[model samples]
Target: MSLDLAWRLLKGGGRKGLLSTWLTLGAVAVSTALLLFAVAVNFAFTARGERGAWRNPVPAASGAVAVEAARFDYVGDKEITVVDLAALKGDAPAPPGLPRFPAPGEVWLSPALAELAGELPADQLAGRYPDPKGVLGDEALVHPGELVAVVGHKADSPVMTAARSQDWIVGKGPVEVASLAGTPSEDSEAYRALTLVASVLMVVPLLVFGGAAARLTVARRDQRLAALRLIGATPGQVVRMTVAEAVIVALAGALLGAAVYAAAAPLLAGIAIGGGPWFVSDVLPGPLVLAVVLVAVPLLVGLSAVAGLRRVVVSPLGVAKRETPPAMRFVRVLALLAALAVFPLLSRGSSVGIVAVALGLAFLCVNLAGPWVVGLIGRVTAGTARKPARLLAGRRLVDDPRAAWRTVSGVALTGFVAGFLGLLSPSAFGDGQESAQLRIAAPVEQAEAVAGQARDRLREAGVTATVRVSKEERGQNRLVAVALGSHAGTPTVDRARTALAGLVPGHTPTTQADDQRFGLQLLADVRVGTIVVLSVSFLVAVASSGITAMSSILDRRQTYGLLRLAGTPLEVLDRARRAETLIPLSVMGGGAILTGVFCALPFMAGGVSTAGLVTLVTCVVAGFAGVIGAGALSRPLLRSVTADPAPRPD
Candidate 1:
């Protein structure tokens, strides 16, 4: 019977009511889709970590089946991950992506590496490794374009010896492995951690947007429920009806959102992070996650819808009389202040889960403080207003601060995102082409012999480089520096490095430029990721503001009609609407931005960057522009709502 009544009430809502329903659903859909995308990052990185885990071999306790060592090699500007393997027994299990254990002298290259090897001269790129017998399967590579190679050698090979490893490099030492399964490398873990942080930055806003959907047509819902309360309806029944309506719409929206995410997964896979684009399969949130989102979203929307009914449930008369609620207290601001205060005190070395939770808490606190700040801004606006529009706008704000906050909350939260990410400037590592010197570490015993061999190799490869041998300490390995001539370029550097590859049994020749590339790539990725995150955030902000603006018109049409009947000009009401949004938006958005900047202070020990400053300025301007544009789009709706200033039956 309740479901039947809920359905009737839904259908009884006229065109305007139905529009509100649709808008609520759309808001849910967008929020759900964005939420799924945010969560996908955690899963994608985890998958990548797993796929690449074999290269980060774990040492066997006693029953060792194989010996392995891994190192990063460079071909021009590109980094190649090289893993050398030697089987202890014929029955040793083949690593992931290999059909069987590699025999001595066998080599396998990932497709990208094979392609690269084919494109370059044999001596420049391919000479270091034996010709590839086969390509590595997808399971062995983190991404499709990852450059990786696996080489097989005899157990007695020097490359598989403990002496071939460097203490500073993770997974570089040869370890006897019972099996290829291992943990993610530090590099992979760093990427996962970063993705987790980025997800927090994204997910909080999405959750807010989802919750806000339930309150889309709050005025209308309150009025309808108040009417039922006066007509002998029980609060429980009214709550059930509200929940039924909100959950029904939300469930539909959530399903739609899941569908949308599924469709966009392929496109989203194109976004490059951690030096490569994700595999499409990696970015997919599996069936369980999708189901969880669908169920959770509707429950959230229903609960949010019910929570707003306190006034109606307790005193329908007050809601019907449209009395101004008590003004919000100053204490609301304390949550945000407390969050910001604790954020910096937490050490950078705190666990990732702890930091992520702190960030999420701080993010939510911004929302908690938003409405109170909006009320204050309204009071100031009303006290200082010289015009009727501004005065009306201010009074409306004081009357319903939560509604006003809802209208501006999207952009205000966006301000937090902008300020937090905008100030993050990746450290400047200069362009990698400045240096032409290649450095290789060689045993002191073989320094002269390697230097002579290096000169011969360079000469034979038609490369002009002067070889110098130096040592920083008495017992340390000798350093072989190949200073390339002025005319030497990428090809020349590659040839020089290749010619000297075997000069040291386990060490790869590297340039200062080569070492800086990792930092450069990481920073570049951060910048790009910042742009993508901000763009998505702004889109949500704009969409939320626009949809909520129109919904606000539906909510207030009767009041608008009465005002029109009292000779209030439509232009004044329109201006008031604009003022109501812009005034609170300015206060709350600016405060949120500052709060975000405060939260970012600990991470900014290196100081601000020019790019970061520029990002902040751009965000401020763009945020304001987006809100204004959303307000403008709703003007026609306002005009329509007040077209006939006559009260009508539902």
Candidate 2:
């Protein structure tokens, strides 16, 4: 019997039931898939790192030798003493066989060292070699100075060429030697942090899509559940039947979504790296996990539906009558009080101020004022609506005021979060002004010359700039820092820096921008796009719920007619409908906004501000008014009650 009844309900609901269920399933599927994809990427990266595939290759001898210096001076008159190969190995090669110490008064160079020497003239290169005794332990190579010649793994040799050098050395013995011990790859803390952030981002799309579907399903079917009760079905049976139907729909949608994600996984991976092609073996494990999420998401959504069924069951009578209590009054009051108390803290630059203001405004607009606003608009607009459709809408709002607010809450919350966070994060905007120390790459010998040239160029361009040269702690590379005028735009700064970087003799220059600007821009884009999506979703839900509610009301027109004949005025009947809408709208709007605010508080406490608060509130209120106005104008459908003279005997 239950199966038969469930089937009947599914068939009756048809497209509407199927759409709502699939939408919910899609939400879950998308969210879970993303989570899975992230996991897979992490796994792939870990596996790659374990293999030591991404490391620099060096000769085996270098790994065994450790050169140390006392009180190492990077820029001062300190020197590196290289250990003798024979001493380190405890074995000496025959005199005539291996050329020891680069044929006396000479030095052996690594591929990197050879490349640096090649950059200078042959005459200049002679002086560039470090004192042979200072580096090697034996002064014999330096004392004789027998035409000091440096022997290195050949520069043009296939395996020993420098990374930055274009030329290669030919005719080489033992072109490259493998290091005796491989260095372990270092773990990236940043990558781990990004993975966590990506995982968190996955939740947003899930909640957004799933919550939207759930709310729409409940709103649209309230009247249907009420009718079921009137026809001798228990509320429990009605709730169970609805849940069963939702589960079926969700499962089908989830399966479909999974299939889509699996097929598209490769494409998504390719896009991740600037749309470059990637091999199947290189594909991250994340997409595969997303495929699994497809099924799991549907099941979870089904569970969520079951959780919400109680609300539909206990209120069938109220559903038919369009009655329910306003939502979150106490919570809203608390939010407002918290907002007031925290206002002072904000003035003191306490980060908590952002949270207090965001919560207070969200509560005031979404919860407290939402229903009343809907009701007022419905009443005022009902009289002005000339079209039958418009009049019918107005009348519906007048009958059930709370329902209007429920429809607008989802979109409002999405907008609020986006706007609030986007404005404060500097990286979100691409301004990149947060780093304390700057590094510029250039040749050691030409470091000062490059700085001077950069200063001259900037001055010629009517921009003041400061330049400083410093050596790296390891004495590996010379660095230059250029401080441009405060008024320089990012593009200007970038251009100037790029031009100046070219003047540096043998070093590549790279710039790091502030992270805050990137974050802010990302948030802003999300806010605008999500709001549009929310708006469309809300409109669909409202239209579906409103039509369903109106149909039920029309079915009971005779009841309304009899009440009118029994001396109830049209105004009172209108108030009753308005009150019905008021209840649901208030509950949904208040709950949604309060929940949104509560969720956003932690982010605000972290640094998001309240400048966008008024805008968010205004948008929410406007949306509510528009929805209510449409409902109020729907009143002409109720004209049938006044048109008929006699009441039907029930």
Candidate 3:
């Protein structure tokens, strides 16, 4: 409990201890920083979304109305059904005297829709703005020359006339229509998806740092703890002391992390929203309160105490001598089994599959096979090495495979998560179908003519198109079709639609088809980002593992020194250690890859193909190689341990 004694003990572990502590701190720092950013962004966006909803709620009749339109081609296919505003109003319909339909050639525009189209150029606009005729192509429902009125729904003001002019062409319709309602208050699907991604990313580094800290606390301090026991210190006292040290370190790291997050919150918010705080209110203090309670405090306290507390309760004498309790092994076994069982459930087609695989692999590699793998690899490599330095490296690895593997595991897990998440970039999904807009003419005969012309034009452009027709209540119409082609730029479906519209003398086509160019661009960006993040994360993991392993090697200096005196060259010793680590790394790496891919198979099967499988395999191989290379590089650390003639008692 003496400050002087604790400081001296802390300083005595030499370079190994110093390096290990720094590594732990660095890992903790990086993990906490990234986690903070992710959490902050998530909260900021969520808050903005919520406020945007409150400021612009959907009108009572907003959900009921829909626009019905035909396909772009002469085949007269049905495309989309715009929301039905009439049904939504029900008993509270617009003044009873109000016309049920807009006067022929005239239409109503919602304030939200008006704002969206306000900036569009008149020449570029294809048809009347905001009218059901423009949106649903219902020519009969609209009267010619009737005044177009812009009505505000769910806004502070009832009606604010927009400065933008309407583009009401006599024959064709607008290419797309804006929704009468504002963005939805809640997108549960998107929230759940982001949460899954964020949780996986956050937990990876937490486990790495926590495990490393725990191992270091128990491993590096064993000799000192053993010496204290010899001086009549009780096991409980030693354990308590170790726990106290961990508490101090965890607390310091956590508090520093939280402070860093708070100071950078503004910057973080900007990144999340893509500009200045968009939905934030200066008058409201609730977000600030929520940030602290929901994000900062819990992260610090939970990460700081979880690992260290467990390590502290163990008997120092036993721990120092490397006599970890049998229960720990049992726990490891149970964890491995649990991970194995959960792997299939995760891989079979859920977003949570990635997290399950990451966690499962961490448990198996770091907690279960670490020591055994390190020792086995070290021993085998030592047998083959001719160089004295290399042999010593092997022996160092073999002498304490567990510590070596622990280092490898930490780095490997970090890399795996980074790579996996990087590869599945959100952009890779492309703007889903939700964002695309499709529009067509109203009259069945006109729609059919437009569809045929579109088909002919697309065929000339070397695209194949199929169109289906359908009718709605009281003469509403639509067209649906899938187009195929090998054009390099825009999707063939979109190109065909455009060409078809041009062929119709007086009609224009409006539809949301795949934008091949945009899709490709998004894919490319995601691929690049994934590669970069994965590579950097992997390298960091590798370096941390090697350093930690070398530190472990140094801790067993006396043991290695005795082995040397017993005619074991430093080369053989180091080789043994390398062999021990290699086996587990390979096993765990393979297992992780298989498990991850297996878990992702169900979801990926629908979209990703054999190519994605290859990509994943490549990632795993690169990750494994990086870890092994790091272990190999730690040989120099072993050379520093002097070979002494005296033998030490086991």
Candidate 4:
């Protein structure tokens, strides 16, 4: 019986209900699709290194085989994950998760690296890999590009001998490498932090859009539910009915999103994750992920609906009274100021965790502060307005600033992202042509300990620095071992030495601009992913904002026509629509840009970043352009509303 009532209520909403439902579904679907896509891609990257289980067969006399262990160490000139292949049909079967084995002179590339091999010129390969030939194939062992190539040398070969002696190698001695396991590869701690940062960029606006869409036609919903309550329906029943409506819309959206994801997966399959394009099979998640998405999306949407219905739930009588909303808090602006104040703490780009956390905070704060800015704009516009249309638009905004802000919140967030991006743009790294080296004057026996100490200390110093060991045994074979590294600032070097004082004896120090090039390589990949995420988020933002604008215009159709019939000019109504959209957008959008810059300023090497400046300018220009465009778009609606000055019944 409740279900029938809920359905009838939705059906009775007519055009308004249908539009709201469509908008809500679209918001949910976009959010779901983006989330699923993000999960799928993360899996594609992170799972590249996880092997099931495999053990050493040489030591397998009568006991169970142990899984092979692989680790990444020495990241400067060349950092590689070494694997042991002793199972050679003697000790035990091949390593459980061995993707494939390369011959003694051959190397297998990860999907990402294979793509690189195909795309990059031969010269670039030579610079990264000396010989660069003997390419083979491996699925579960490498992290794209030249990271996980297997060598066929015996456990005691000179090549394996040198690798085992490195400070970063975890194992004591070189073992026969049956096959290279892919588990445990790159996407460093810094990388995960980056992922978090990226997810926030895409996910926040999604939450906002989804929430906003869920509450579309709040006034209408509240009034209808209040009438139901007055008719002796219990609050619980009314709540249940509203919730039922929310669930239906959410479920429909989730399904639509899933369909969109399924259709989009194949297209994304070709996007290179590590070094090569991921396979189509890897682009979609398992049944478990799908199940979670199905359940969670509707739950979130329903919750949003419930939150919006809070007013009605508390006092059903309020729905009929048209009470003014509480003024938007001025404290929201403090969030942006606080973010700016803390940004300069990130100057040297030393801490990835700090960087990611700070950026995330800045993004969030700017959004929180957006509404206050809208209210301010409304006040100012209303105060200064001389024209009737402008005055009406300003008054409406002053009357409901939260709604005014919501209409363009997406664009505001986008502007903030743009401001943030300008600060951290890849171009800031210059040509990324800097190179670095680390020379160790320690005995071969002490090399490993010294390297280990260096890394541990570097970690303490909050730097994601990678250390490299020499491939050749020439310089490092005797008392003086050579460990190469790139781009360590003086402070990082000093800290490393202090930590290595009693542990290992060695002195190695150097910082070159080119080392930033290596850093850029990592950031470049991350940048690509970030761009994709932001682009999607922006589209969703624009669409959602546009939907709200259209809905607002439609909802006020009668008021607009009445004013036209009374004394106001059609042009004035048109101007009012333009003013309402333009004023709040320009104000909030500007605030977002400033907030973004403030948050990003600290991470920026210098106070001013060219990219950020460009971004700020672009946002301003774009915001103004958007206002003009919005005004132009709203003119026709104004004309139609004024055409029949008489009130029309639904």
Q: Pick the candidate with the highest TM-score.
A: 1
Pairs of colliding residues, candidate 1 = none
Predicted candidate 4 versus true structure: per-residue lDDT over 1-650, tens digit per residue: 67779988777777656765676677778778877876666565454434312211132234422223343322333444444342244344433323334334444444444454455443333222334344444444433344553334343334344432243233323443333332242333345556666666666777677767676656567777877886788877887897899888888888998999999887887665444455566668889988997888788778878877766767777665767667777778877788677776667555666766766677677667776777778888889988888889888888777677777787888777766665665455555442333444345665566566667765765555565454434245322222324554433443443333323311223233322434556656655664676566566656666667665766566677778779888877776877787777767777777677666665565456564466557655655555455446656655765688887653
Question: For candidate 4, what is the TM-score?
Answer: 0.72
lDDT of 2 by residue, 1-650 (tens): 65577768766755535544444555444444444454455554444333322121233444322111001000011111121121123222211112442333344543323443455433223233444322221121211111212222222332222122111111111212232122322222333333343333333433444433444446556667668777888866876776666666666655664566567667654532211223334444554565566555655665666665565576666766657533423454455456445433443233333544444454344434544555665766677766544465566556554445444433444443333333333222444443322345555666688678777866765555677886552144466777665665544454453354325322223334422322443454445433433443344334433443444344456667876787766766666565445444554545555455454444453354344455456545655665566457547656655567496442
| Predicted candidate 1 versus true structure: per-residue lDDT over 471-541, tens digit per residue | 64223577788899777788888888788876776678888777687788888888988887788789789
Best by lDDT: 1
Query: Which candidate model has the greater TM-score, 1 or 2?
Result: 1
- The per-model lDDT (C-alpha) reads 0.86, 0.44, 0.45, 0.59
Ranking by lDDT: 1, 4, 3, 2
Error of 3 at 242 (Å): 1.5
Those runs of model 1 whose alpha carbons end farther than 4 Å from true positions after fitting are 165-171, 428-430, 472-475
Winner of 2 and 4 under lDDT: 4
State each candidate's clash count: 0, 60, 73, 29
Model 3 over residues 457-566: C-alpha lDDT tens digits?
A: 65776656564443531223344333342332234334444455434322334433322323443454445434534554554566556656666665676767777777
Error of 4 at 496 (Å): 36
Higher-scoring candidate on TM-score, 1 or 4:
1
